[model samples]
Target: MTDEKNMNHNNEEIIEKAKKFFREIIAENHVKNTEKLENIKEFKVNPFTHKYLANFLTGNDDPKSLAKALIYPRVLGTSITTSFGQNLQTFVNTTLEGYGSTTTGMDIEFIDKLDGRKKYCQIKAGPQTINKDDVTTIRNHFRDVINLGRTNGIPIANMDCVVGVFYGTYNDLSAFYKNLAEDYTVLAGKDFWYHLTGDEDFYNKLTDAIGEIANEFDGTELLEKTINQLAMQLQQVDGIDE
Candidate 1:
């Protein structure tokens, strides 16, 4: 009975640590995103533009969205920099890291131990992005890793590469990758999520959590402020100076 209690206590402690670390990661990214929004140059109401004000007055969903829509540069810049696909990868990486796994670098290398053997994973957004160049790079990287292992007398079979993708299938990949895909353990979509969490619904829960975090930074308040400022510019157009 005492041993079972101790095991439960350990599990609880691990759960708490995971929650704290995950929250901190989200909070840190939120701060950075807020800073980016704040640093964008103040929105100026162009006198010649008539649609912007109208959109602000009666836009789809709410005035807040219209106000946000008017900041064309900010919208485009954030989309380009923090793309949805990239954000999804960030969610996956941070979640894994919170669970005490080591996530590293561009391709999101997740190093883990499986059946007393080391497994090296590379996660990609989709197979569509996997071109000949990517295959060559992966091949060379594994070659170097194998050579290093052999030099140290550690047997490494192709570096035990595993590729996990958020989307896309073998059909989506080009011909070269299709053939090479057989050499690696390729996990797609739910299979990838299942491999990570042992639950196929894990990705659904992750996406829901991501959506909630996204709502917090939708820039609603900032949009309202911009609309108010633009209203002041509208007054100027009406020959009223404030």
Candidate 2:
């Protein structure tokens, strides 16, 4: 019993250490992204800077203030967002190992060399909001791939295009899939996870894993602590600059 308890404690420590490591990475990236944003002419002179600075000086760790300081700048049509997107693609790649490699011209790509087949994947965070422009873009890309194969005398008939969305209440996405050709597939929520994992209940397991993590640590407290650290760093920088 004592040995089992010690093992559990060690696992908890490992989890907490991993969480802290990721937090530090994100915080370091936040600082780097802020520097990049400051170089942009429009962002440099943006009125939001004054507000964010004022909030930081006041030690206000409000969610919006933290977002302005950390997340907003990173996501502002910059390379930071693109880099983050690639990181997320990597996460999916690691999670779906033994599947295939991530290829260009799509968000996630899978090549099955054994069958001379491939799956071009597009991933979105949520369901029920399929962008028409993105659909058009993907369709054009697939068309080009097929056309390219025909020109080279290597007919690629086993190619398929797919979209995977993270979460939604509704399971039926047939209406959206119908917009594409018969070779295309649209999967949402659990169906998407099942397609990738080949485990019908993997979605539930994923959610349960998330719940376990939440139970292991207080995410809210960690987030607040990070915001406080960011606020202090910004304040120090302002003092030095002035």
Candidate 3:
């Protein structure tokens, strides 16, 4: 009974540590994103005009989508999803250093708290970004990291590799991840978070934090203004009515 209690206590501490690391990344990125938000208007829109104009010339007659195209580079501070995955991995590296785990300076290398084995993960914001060709590269990376660790004194048996999908469940994962599944372990959504800190809800908990950040940062004023600007630009363009 005493042994079980100690294990539970340790698990709680690990979960708390992971949460603290997530908060640090959120706070740090909030500042950086805010700064980018200030200069939102300056982001280039020239490319979008040409790209969408071509679409207009083709079959896409909807001028309304132009605003969305503009928003990608301007608002949301240039792909928040992409930034979140990178930042999450980064903060985890920091936590690994302070915690019992060691930072391997690779993609996302850390020791799993639940198991004594070390994990080297290729963290992705979502499964959609992975392509068929990326599978081979991912596998090769794992092999290389294992060899590197062996050289550094960590045995091959003591280490494992994984493709950590930041969001979505296994069933929801894209077909591209099919190839990866045949090789190394692929943990997604709740399971992936559990693998990291032994906390199943870690994914949801931190993602809820991200939602709160979105609520705080997803201002309607700028969005409406940008859309209005794009609408006028579209009006200037010769609209093709189908």
Candidate 4:
């Protein structure tokens, strides 16, 4: 029992040392990129290391900060993980092995090769469509899985785990994308002529009205008539209810 205790203590010391090393490396990287050091937190090199790192990089470390960052495409649009579908299976295998997890629910679906490059594999979640709720659940699950792996001394790298997290996020958000498409279609259907109103006559009249307004105050009547006509035309074309 004493021996076991000593071994466990030693293992913990090793983990602490590893964590410090990782923290320094990450700090250096952030510094190189002109990111403020205060913006970076100390690194924890556990199974969930990548998840934490990804979260930090993506500005998801705090709920409020994440909400603000979500408005613009920062990490989501500008990370290696965004293009992870290009090599799905390899990423999955690497991440799973890194985390030392018994491959649970691991199935690969083939997506078309992009630009004649890598053949993509989409990691399937289950036999059902993914939704927004599923996305939150899966992301949490991934964090748990990765942290478990790290605690076990699995020797998994951050890169391996990050790839998996990216793929998982992508799969989970698929439904959201579908919903967006449907919503766009509905909106477009409601305002069909909003996009189709760019006729030569419309452009000419608009230009003439603008010139008249700029050139003469006496053009107010003409401007009002032109504006009313344009509004009527747009309302008619868009099928708007009177």
Candidate 5:
């Protein structure tokens, strides 16, 4: 009888340790801070916009978070943006309204290798009067979008092909583009986007990736329950000693 009781005590102590470890990990990671409650007031004014806002802010329910987490780190370190980056940006902006900026600072160029001609797929973020904060927000929003894309199985290495446009002198633009180009292959035409649209394979891969991420988020509740149970078991063990 004493042996059995000792074994139970040991088990309980182990569970307590586990609970403490998890609590510390969660706290240090700021996992609960996934959403900013104060910002909710501004977000709630537009219900439709708010819905998308939740996805970006709350990593638990946001499929985009998974995608972004997977892709952003790979590309951010590099000076060049890839095809995957462009497509991912398009996907995020379209899905989440008001997520991107309205600055016409960046332009997309399409080059035709055969004809030695260039066509433009110009996307104006918004207007010339757009503020720096808005631009930063827009950039960060896209970065999150890229993260979402990664969670969806879009590889960051494939981001080569997209170009950044800036409003400045030729030297500035050229220098920026040249630096970026050194690290990535620019898409010659808008054909890549069209190809992406028509590619059922890519869609299937994205769907599967998103589903996997959703499943992981859903598991968090179960994880919490398990933690609570373990803590209770530990408390019981400590009581028996008293």
Candidate 6:
């Protein structure tokens, strides 16, 4: 138990690098995105949608204030997560033992050298992250890749494609997951991490590392300041209350 515990703690080389990268990425997102909020030229209001939701949702609170609250953080959160997701792919490619970036979202470009067969992967953050349209788009992407490979003398039978979800259980996933699984490999959480690193416990270890690193960053001031900044901007918007 002690040696096992030590191994987990000592797995910090990658974890530590992940920690540094994660912090830098998050902090950079905060500084860069928050400034963009300050330079906002306008806030477009969908009068009908914004009006009804604000009245019913906030129990008659000022809709304009509500709009500011919604717009800033929602946009910021989406921007951060989307960019963070991109960085995550780079992180995995660089930090993991046998992964690297790909031209067409391939799982292991290196796999072809080993078995003379190519493997491609389209990765998502979670099972619920994809929708019906996304599935169709992914299917199209796969088709295009396979066609391109065929032109290069690679047969279809030698190509494998995967939809890899970083976290979730397959049995508990959505119809979208099932749809993808109908035609390609779908791995989630433990299965996904295991597929990449061949260690079933990697997901747990990864979460543990993330949890520890997360505790080091305190965002109290940032959050409060952002809300204030956004709230102030509402005053400048023309006809926001209407």
Stretches of candidate 2 off by over 4 Å are: 1-87, 107-118, 128-130, 148-159, 169-183, 220-242
- Return whichever of 3 and 6 wins on lDDT: 6
The residue-by-residue lDDT of candidate 2 on 105-221, one tens digit each, is 556655422333566667765554456776687677767666766788956552466666765534454345547535666667877665554456656766555445434444354
Ten-residue region with minimum lDDT total, candidate 1: 98-107
Model number with the top TM-score: 6
lDDT of 1 by residue, 2-86 (tens): 9547644543443443344445564455444443443223444453543555465466424334344555444446433355445
Question: Best-fitting candidate, measured by lDDT?
Answer: 6
Q: Whose TM-score is higher: candidate 1's or candidate 5's?
A: 1
RMSD (Å) of each candidate, 1 decimal: 7.3, 10.2, 6.5, 28.0, 23.1, 5.8
Candidate 6 lDDT, tens digit per residue, 36-154? 55433434555556656656655653734455445554555776677667676666665543445355645444233224444677767766788899889888877877788789886
**Sorted on lDDT, highest at the top, how do the candidates line up?**
6, 3, 1, 2, 5, 4
TM-score for each predicted model, relative to the true structure = 0.52, 0.47, 0.61, 0.20, 0.21, 0.64
Q: What TM-score does prediction 6 earn?
A: 0.64
Each prediction's Cα lDDT score? 0.52, 0.52, 0.62, 0.32, 0.34, 0.63
lDDT of 3: 0.62
CA error at residue 24 for candidate 6, angstroms:
2.2
Q: Write the per-residue lDDT of candidate 3 for residues 1-242, one digit (tens) a residue.
A: 99558656655554565556545666456445544433325445465364565365444635445555545453455455556666765655554443423334345655565776777777776767787778778877777777887789976542377777877889988887866787677878888777776666677766665455444445566556555666566667564221
What C-alpha lDDT, on a 0 to 100 scale, does residue 136 get in candidate 3? Answer: 74
Q: What is the model-wide C-alpha lDDT for candidate 5?
A: 0.34
- Model 1, position 167, has a per-residue lDDT of 59
Number of clashes recorded per candidate: 0, 0, 0, 4, 16, 1
Candidate 5's residue-wise lDDT over 1-242, tens digit each?
99547644543443343334334432222233322211212111333443344356554423333223322332233211233233434433443222233424323333323343332222322113234464454444445545654788854342423433312222433333344445433222223322322232433433343334333334354334433443344334322121
List clashing residue pairs in candidate 6.
Answer: 107-121
